[model samples]
Target: MELAIGIILGCCALGAGICMGIGAIGPGIGEGNAVSKACEAIGRQPESKGAVTSTMIMGCAISETTGIYSLVIAILLIFVAPNILVNVLLKAIGLM
Candidate 1:
């Protein structure tokens, strides 16, 4: 039972780590692509620089929300999962 609990906790931590690690990739790529395109647009039409920048910033900020959620989940999993698991374990063992 203890071993099972430990394994569950470990899995949660590992999953959280993976989630944060892989979850960042999409936003990173998207932000990079957005900036690159925005730069190109500005280069082509310097007069539209301000508008392009503002739009790019807005788009990037929206795109970043998923990464932020993943980060929050990762943090919760890292900090909260173990405690919840421990509590469940204790309850299962009739010690809580």
Candidate 2:
């Protein structure tokens, strides 16, 4: 039972890392592309730079939000879940 718990914790940590790693990739690329396009658009149309800059900032913010969400999930999985599980296990074992 203890071995199983250890294995589960390890898997959770690994999974969380993998999830965050995968999650960061697409959003990073997308945010980069958004800024690039926004700058290009502004350069092409100086009069509309304000609108383009605002839209770019909004899009980048949204894209970054996804990465933040993933980081939250990863932290929960790696740090929070295992601690909760250990507490639950102690309670079950009548050691808490």
Candidate 3:
């Protein structure tokens, strides 16, 4: 628990939190916006609704991938790394 390591850990935690929160926000907004736009397009061009729906789906899938990665990283950071670090430190001190 040196000062520098503590600071680094805090920063990592903050970054991971921010990443996950923003990731969820961005994708949710993007998907909503995409759906809205697709609906508008369909309303304007009823004959091309199928094409609009397909493109919207593809774009949403691509946009959502980044959010998924962020979630996975955040989960690993928050749930996995701290425990592993604690175990390593405890073993090094022969207290575990």
Best by lDDT: 1
lDDT of each: 0.93, 0.88, 0.85
The CA root-mean-square deviation of candidate 2, after full C-alpha superposition on the true structure, stands at 2.5
Expressed as tens digits, the lDDT of each residue in 18-77 for candidate 3 is 989988988999999999999999999999988999999999998898799999999888
TM-score of 3: 0.69
Off by over 4 Å in 1: 1-5
Give TM per candidate. 0.87, 0.74, 0.69
The pairs that clash in candidate 2 are none
Q: Write the per-residue lDDT of candidate 1 for residues 10-82, one digit (tens) a residue.
A: 9998999899999999999999999999999999999999999999999999999999999999999999888
- Model 3 scores worst on lDDT over the 10 consecutive residues at 1-10
Please report how far candidate 3 places residue 71 from its true position, in Å.
Answer: 1.1
lDDT of 2: 0.88
- Tens-digit lDDT string for candidate 2 (55-82): 8899999889889989999989987899
